[model samples]
Target: MLFLFFCPGSFGADTDEVFVMEGDSVSLTCLKKNQQDRIKWYYNDIRIAQMNGDPSKTCTDVQCNEGTERFRDRLKLDHLTGSLTITNIRDTDAGEYKLLITRGNSDSEKIFSVSVHDKVFVMEGDSVSLTGLKKNQQDRIKWYYNDIRIAQMNGDPSKTCTDVQCNEGTERFRDRLKLDHLTGSLTITNIRDTDAGEYKLLITRGNSDSEKIFSVSVTGVPAAEQDEVKRKTVKEGESVTLDLDVKRNPNDVMTWHFNDILIAEITEDQSQICTDFQCENGEERFRDRLELDHQTGSLTIMNTRNTDSGEYKLKINSISRRRRRSVSSEKRFDVTVTASGLSSGAVAGIVVVLLVSALTAVGVGVIYHRHRSPRKAVEEKQRASVESPNKEKEIFLQTQIEIT
Candidate 1:
């Protein structure tokens, strides 16, 4: 969490790469993003090519009858010049492609380029694969969870999606979790394991946040842990499963550190998982150690405590390329606690079942005056005031094991 690692040195630059085209072999590899023994290339401004050229020949060209006339078969350089390999592409050979550099030896132009993608398509099977990115129709499309932004239109009616999931503890299936209309989608009827997750579909046009990363692989069937605060054992009582696999995003702001100092800060813009055990912190001992299995974000720790060890984080937010905006994926869980715990024989068996039900209610009131049968002594005093042998031996077993 050193703020996404001392800031991720700018976010976009590979000679600014973005030359989507088609028609045949086109290799415009003139990369000098920041530095490289000099660079050069210009077409309409005439100059030909030269990016450390003449090492063994690597900038070739030949267009005889495709885009009108040309300078005839030319392939300059001997080593590795500015890069060029246009073989039979047309569309009048497009336009604008420059990169002239030189400041150490004085000759400059720095860098200035552009590319308008003309092809980008994909289609693949049974789950989902709808693609399209041109941007117009009012230019503003938002859909995320993988990069934070779950459907926003700017044409706000108070901006809704329940304002992006407002604290949903449980309802068994109240209206079954919605958001399928704006077409950003977040549906659920039955998809189990509490619906394994990692969904995305963010498409924004104005403020630019696009480079395609639309993923979706949910598989639900889990609930019970939004109210959290019920998975015991503190410093000595071992035993723990109380699942918890949680994730969150909004440019990332999640902090669930239990010992390194901090215990829960999932602003809930969206990112969930908690196969339930119990956890909370607006109060209480605040414990829900995280198990989020919406397809493995893995935070399972059942029986360990020096107060349950330390170091934990989830911090979010990211956008670099000099565009600046840090904090992205801050993970560092190192919890490890053990003193070989002990629960004092389960607290002396709950204090000998409350001192033998107070000596069996004073020997059933002196044997109910020696003759008994007062409705069998009031049904054994209401089963010893309701279950006490450690809550009647906790017998709840159901086995159907066939899991393949």
Candidate 2:
């Protein structure tokens, strides 16, 4: 799994981005004020380690039982201070690293970013070294071929492996690959043409992942030999002719298959037995629609249907005049039958309906505007007429006060 780092800053800080060359070690600190609570470590949202709640029973580094396989032995958990130290990082290990600690009823979290650089080269039948960037710690390297796990080197939590216990790879890589247990570098010997593809190294430590991708290409692949597949598209209910162009012979044998099911066969004596069309053993699906041209061994369907769209295979056996055995050859044809689109009459009907609907909408809008304009004018005139009486009453009151 690859992760996108979301936190900011680089190195040392609580939410920092740590950049390291492909095979270096980095330490991520998780400080907690509460010493009695358990400390949990997560990488890209996956919980990788959790210490016992009691700090007295906690050790310096304890491997977790349940988590991602990439983090198996690379984590050095500090039970005393809740810090993590990762060794021998690979490029894949770059991502978000998080630490969770709870004290009393309050919880705290710390997130960091780690990036590892990866470099690779392609070669045929040559050994390649993927440096783990850390030395003497032999437990955190895993190699994968095309995303399938091929090998891994790991050791016990109490001590690093001086004599590495690396597991054998899958069947395709058996006895061909080797890993340096001390530094986490992978070397494959006796590389073959089939081994040309993607290889990845996943180094996980401090609850984070570093990855390296290697692409390999090999020369010398035999050229493929096969007849070109002929393609044809025909409208449904139309006539279609499939040409075989084989000359009839006394010892010649011919067979026809539709989608790999034998539909017709011709014996060496020029006798035909068929479940397809125009033969003695006729099938119901193709009964009256099929016709066979005996001289050229061609098949013609008068009314092609959508169900007839499929691959058609023709096999011919040419019998040598001197030898008793026959040499077989085959040709393939792909036929597609499609429905002819809507007719002109149907299109005309649809256009007529659309035009009528548009005109009706326009007429309705015009009628609404014409009726609403007069009503609006009448309401405004009535409002002006009502305000004139109030204005006259106010003037009369002022005149009476002046006279008094």
Candidate 3:
């Protein structure tokens, strides 16, 4: 027999938290059962912004000389639903935010907590541990790599696999992982270049759940002799050259891929440039612009356009005449090109405009969702609760009308 208990101050309210990539925009809504007369927002217990329904007035504390400088120009209010929109969010902007809505004779309060971290870098061949910081909660723990379950800790005492069992798990991390049952921490040993990606830990206690994310970046891979990231800024219509310092043999196959799409291939002692099995000179985008250095397998673009800025990868299959075997090597380069007349300020302005436009579009969609149907809102809420990474706690707000 199992029993579930709902604690005091936990009922009649819903708490939601969100994690976003750096520089991304986010929207936080204090969902209510009925429209309120006024909504006020607070950050870390300090009142920040307020919106009144009767006068149609919405202003931040900055407008009345009472708000902090942190949210001066980045916060906006959705008057209809009492949702808050944050733009160009940074790591420093992460913290606890509260919302207070005034109804006919009562005031309702809601809180939201946000946390942000860009990435975590670990050296290859070293070990790393991802921690979930709940001290007293004993529950089921599941760890995922790119959304695929890697390891799980079953709460059942009679179960065979209580802690870490990767043999039946994914092949990529079968023998290289360990999980701490008490702390809900996952440890990866002998980390390789392929293990550099996103990792998530989902913890479920009773009906409450929360998740933490870790973006692992493995370094110190010495397979190649070049920098992982090379920076080169060029003006529009200028020429650029990307080189692969691999010696090509007479029958070795050297291929160049642009943005993950195959562009050109060299075979027959580097004399032929073919798109596929057929021997051809150039493709639609390269035209007469590509020149190959046969000796070193270097590619030079004669006239570069703005569209040429992206990732350029090189793959070479070096055939060994003596051993009758081949060895393959891969290299990539990220290129960035700028217009000749655009200044730094102009570029920043363009980025801001694009982000603002994106936020506005998302706001319109949220408003449509709120006005369209309550059933839709409830459905979306359930979906969000199931999928939300930081949904370990649930807050239930008292509704004006009870659903029978």
Measured on C-alpha atoms, candidate 2 has an lDDT of 0.62
Alpha carbon deviation, residue 18, candidate 3 (Å): 6.0
lDDT of candidate 2 over 290-364, digit per residue (tens): 665666556677778899999877666555443222234455678899997875778999999999999999999
Question: TM-scores of all models?
Answer: 0.28, 0.28, 0.36
> Which is the better candidate, 2 or 3, if ranked by lDDT?
3
What candidate 1 gets wrong by more than 4 Å, as runs, is 1-81, 84-139, 142-152, 156-236, 239-253, 256-281, 287-404
Q: Show how many residue pairs clash in every candidate, following the order shown.
A: 39, 9, 10
CA lDDT of each prediction against the hidden true structure:
0.40, 0.62, 0.66
Q: Work out how many backbone clashes candidate 1 has.
A: 39
Give the per-residue lDDT digits (tens) of candidate 3, residues 220-322: 7564533433435567777877775557677778788888777778877434666422335334776777787777777777657788899887776555453
Q: Pick the candidate with the highest TM-score.
A: 3
Q: Which model, 1 or 2, shows the larger lDDT?
A: 2
- Candidate 2 regions exceeding 4 Å error are 1-229, 245-250, 268-282, 342-404
Clashing pairs in 2: 23-133, 91-210, 91-211, 92-209, 92-210, 92-211, 93-209, 93-210, 93-211
